[model samples]
Target: MTDRRPLVAGNWKMNGLSAAAAELDALAKALADRPAPACDVMIAPPFTLLAPFVAAASGTPIAIGGQDCSHLEPGAHTGDIAAVMLRDIGATSVIVGHSERRQDHHETDDLVRLKAEAAHEAGLVAIVCIGETEPERDRDQTLNVVTTQLAGSVPDAATADNTIIAYEPVWAIGTGRTPTAADVATVHGTIREVLVERFGEDIGNGLRILYGGSVKPANAGELMAVANVDGALVGGASLKAADFDGIIDAYR
Candidate 1:
């Protein structure tokens, strides 16, 4: 088997409130029952819920993270939360360059790289997301686009400890659609090759690559078992404890 460890990261996106910590509490309890999961598990919730969730999952192995963090230097950025701020709030990881941020905030690959760098500076693992739009996929530009984004968005300093890659087809996120296992294998293999070329064999091969886009319990087994797919970056299914655990069980 590959040296990469499986990493299942739940991205809560812009959803959740204080009341949502119950799910985190439940997940923490479940994790307590199984002290050692075969893979690492993470939950990136909305910023508003991080504190409460962290408090709720105090002694458990359930890691909490942020959906996004400001890449800008520490300063008065109004609504922006700096990477260090995320660290201060007990976030062990953060997702950078998510498609929603890319499309909605007009974040370029350069900006995403800066954010990832910032996350590393603050001692947080950065889960960088890359994907092709429906049109781009249809145009057969998926590989080219993804490789370009991978080169630009992934910092030269990335290491297994500080960086994770998630491939989420734009049209598939929350749409209940997914690429075939062969398709996932092809893309993930391509990504690994690029990583090995850019970062060298050892470092590149050890970085975890996760599949995202409508990931649910029913489809997780096949997706997780793909040649280069180390785990999943779950969305809606992650919002519920039962659903997320089921997805995590794919590794089991």
Candidate 2:
């Protein structure tokens, strides 16, 4: 087992505004006097709030990130923001290949791979997400599907410092239905095996693998305690200061 520090990252998704700044403020205050964990803490808000959030998190253990970014550095992609731009605005990380993008926008693994490369090229940490849907799970193809996504979405140059993997089962996200501990162990272990096979034991063992999907304060500690479950990619629970802070406390 590697000694990689755990990380609890909040995905604010499309929520938050200057008015919502209170949430982050509250979170900052809650984390202030508490002993920092052996893990890292990150929050990914929408593009519109990245700068303000980054500013608020300065001098704190909290790191701010972007939800997604365009693969191209700069272009006429109009609405699309590039990874370099996010970095320029003080974002320390970016989430790539999230299940929502894959399902809603029909994004393929190849596209996710390119975006991850863009994040790497821009010197930003990439949190690549991969998991199977409900049907895939029901059909007993969870491992196969997850492995394929892990293989295709993660780039070859991936390292512990530059990358993190979040397993967010499409079925579990926002549905309040989490897999059993044994189930989570099985998948995470398989993911570790794949990483070792592809990246060699040294780097693979050091990689951080997070479990996401309906993760809340109630279950955060239990999930974090599981072998290979280094952290979480929180969804709705991340939108509120109290809830997100609770999940962070679970790491302690």
| Winning candidate number (lDDT) | 2
Q: In model 1, state the lDDT of residue 54.
A: 77
Give lDDT per model, in order.
Answer: 0.91, 0.91
TM-score (all chains, Cα) for each model: 0.97, 0.98
138-220 per-residue lDDT for model 1 (tens digits): 99999999999998999999998899999999989999999999999999999999998989988889899999999999999
Model 1 segments more than 4 A misplaced: 34-36
lDDT tens digits, residue span 139-227, model 2: 99999999999999999999999999999999999999999888999999999999999999988998899999999899888888889
lDDT of 2 at 106: 95
Task: Name the TM-score of candidate 2.
Answer: 0.98
Model 2 residue 21 distance off true place after TM-score fit, in angstroms:
0.8
- Give Cα distance to truth, residue 106, candidate 2, Å: 0.6
Q: RMSD of model 2, in Å? A: 0.9
Candidate 1, number of clashes: 0
